[model samples]
Target: MSCCSTSLAAARSFGSVCSPPLTSSLTQMSSMLDTAAEQMMVHKDFQAALDTCDRGLESLANMEQEDSRCGEVKAGFCILGIQALAELNQWHGVLSWVLQQYEHQEKIPAKIMQMCILLYSKVGEPAVMQEAARVWLHCPSNSRVTGFRTVAELYLLHVLVPLGHRDEALELIVGEVGGSAFTEDQRQAALDVVEEKEQQKQEPPLNPSPNSETTAHTSSTQGAVVRKLEAMLRFFYRKLLLTGSGSFSLRKVFTAAVLLYMLFLRLDPAHPSSFMWISKLLQLLKQMWSAMFAPYHQALTHSKGL
Candidate 1:
């Protein structure tokens, strides 16, 4: 028999002893394609690597109705394809491919979606990155991926902010920080972005000459700062109040209170709303302090009574 025939006969024999013929065939095909693509990339044959990735993706499409294991394999193939395109500096091509896949499917795989976001960021396409971030946030499988929340935050700070999407960036950060789905680290990262942006807003223009344009710009910035400060205060207050049962962390409460105090000081003292927020923050801090000492107070009272 010829080499091809002999290899086919051996594959069939192996498949008979394994799980299923189609599953084995697909698995082997994916592995072989991945290896070939990697080798081509190492050799700097980017076009050849891209061609191999295309073949792998075609195979994935043909096996669309497969099991969960197969779905994962397909996602891997998609990632490989994206990487190959990136190696070739075909960023727009990668975006088009991802968008086309999104248009056809109800949901793209989480790993694939991540690759798309990373590609957009790599290509400096902030508008596309923002849209990808929105889709990623809403994806049902997003929670399964590790570090997705951090990735979302980085995208907000690095992409959205530079693109002048300040409102959208703040909205995304506030939503994540306020929601229970985020971890302390993620919440803190979002808060850092808020603080950084607030500082930038507070910086006076180097050119102090009075002009209509500069005055208008300064007013707009001040307004945005006030709104961000209010949003952050609300978030920290909710966090302080929600510390129940095993979730009570005194350190977190203290941190939130300190941040609120700093923000209060940053606000314009003449503004009527600033005074209201300052009073509210002080009351919340007092309540938290009392709550922290309540158990000790009860113990002291009981001992004295005894």
Candidate 2:
């Protein structure tokens, strides 16, 4: 991917420019940063790029306080370094490496925080950035940056919501931190979304059994019977796999036949004594039947579209 010209200089002096010089002028430091960028973009040598960024950041450390150019240059190198780490698939090290540069989570730049949030979210590990993003968002200094609201939103959606931190997410929407990040209407919407998620969590999972209210209320007898039969077979297959015992032995099949006989051939709903036992058995079996399924069933369903 192409990078900003300011962040990635031309590739003329693109040799590994590690430790340019402690006394590098703005021009010299700028050239050194180009080496790291070239290593990343042109050479595709991400490790070399990270090495160069490290040296450039070290050179810019003292100069950062004296010159605005130095800070920009350092941020450029940091960005390059971050991309290099991601390219290398060293996701686990990203947060720690960033914290090493800033010394504190709250001190990391907002732009970098935004990048980390997106990166971790992409890697399916948004929980990794939750604490760091939370700390940075709470920092008053970072609260006014242009990317502040973006960071807040990403943290809420990508990190907090995915990780199920409802209490903290709700607080962030209505609390002072959110006051600067989100408007009243957005806050209300966020609140609604959070509450909805909570309600979903509290509700029991929909049972796909033949005896469920959904199945019983169906108008089509044929469709209901088909669904119930499928559910029954799936439950039996899953239970056999889950128990990991006997490995689909014929003995298990015979046992199933006995239960089927008791239900269909023997049990009579008109008789109160038989009705009680049937209801109790169905209830117990329904409890035992989980949504879990064997991998073979999944493969079969996918291949045959069943």
Candidate 3:
């Protein structure tokens, strides 16, 4: 049999053994495989490409669990898998898979960015295109590789403006590209839209949502907290691994003592009680470090016990 024929049979057989695996484990494995497949794509081997595409499809088939993380992975894999199917002239599969993926993919920004153009072309659906525009406005500013502007333009002209959402469309245009990247002509075009909306309204512009910027700021803070917590846990794990459970030394004790000393610098501005607890924790930590390490240092030189 041809390699493609063998690969297709193997993919089908593997897919049929469908006892559900742990969602987290499956997601991690799928992501690892996806990254490896992406790297392997540089080789441009058709059989490998087919195998990679099949892996994505396999992940997509199992993505319907209640877990959001698994859903996100499935959505991503669906887009990638469909893209591969398209490249191979699997038109019927592409049609079926893209529709299925779109219906179930939870509509995240990255998936929207990945599949919008092709899906729009294939489906010729204005509503789906508008969704792509909505996602683009809220997508991260740094994600310029997505061509959000182009996607927005397609939706605005072909979908939103024609759907009698010209005013809403204008607001999105201003918010996305007005001040910095937009041309003078583009700015004027948007301003004309605002003026048009103003003529329809008796009052001034409505207040922007209080939580919009706050939500973005809070999201950033949460990301930082996660990173810091991960770093701390890794540090603790490494220390445990290296030190085994036991003891410490003078330099080690001194270093930990210095850390406790620095803890005093982070004073509680709100309450005196916090300061008291801070001092107490520091003292305890210092004592623990000293008890653990000081004897080790003493025994080395003087052969003395704590």
Give the TM-score of each candidate: 0.52, 0.60, 0.32
lDDT score of residue 135 within candidate 1: 62
Ranking by lDDT: 2, 1, 3
The TM-score obtained by model 2 is 0.60
Q: Model 2, range 154-271, lDDT digits (tens) per residue?
A: 8998898878889999989989899999998989988888888888888887864656766556536635554565466556656665666345574378357647856674656686
lDDT at residue 202 of model 3 (Cα atoms): 45
Q: Relative to the unseen true structure, what is the C-alpha lDDT of residue 195 in candidate 2, on a scale of 0 to 100?
A: 85
Against the true structure, what is every candidate's RMSD? 23.5, 15.2, 21.4
In model 3, state the lDDT of residue 175.
64
Model 3 TM-score is 0.32
- In order of listing, the candidates' clash counts read 0, 0, 0
User: How much is 289 displaced in model 1, in angstroms?
Assistant: 89
Tens-digit lDDT track of model 3 for 1-306: 122333233323333233455456665645544553453344535445546655664665665554544554444454445444545555345534555555532244343343444444454455655654565555556235344455555555556654557667777667654433356797677557556655666465588677999988966875674455445434544554456437345336545644664465453537553454445445655655565567667778685442
Give the whole-model CA lDDT for all candidates, comma-separated: 0.60, 0.72, 0.51
- Candidate 3's C-alpha runs over 4 A off are 1-24, 45-65, 89-96, 102-110, 118-154, 157-306
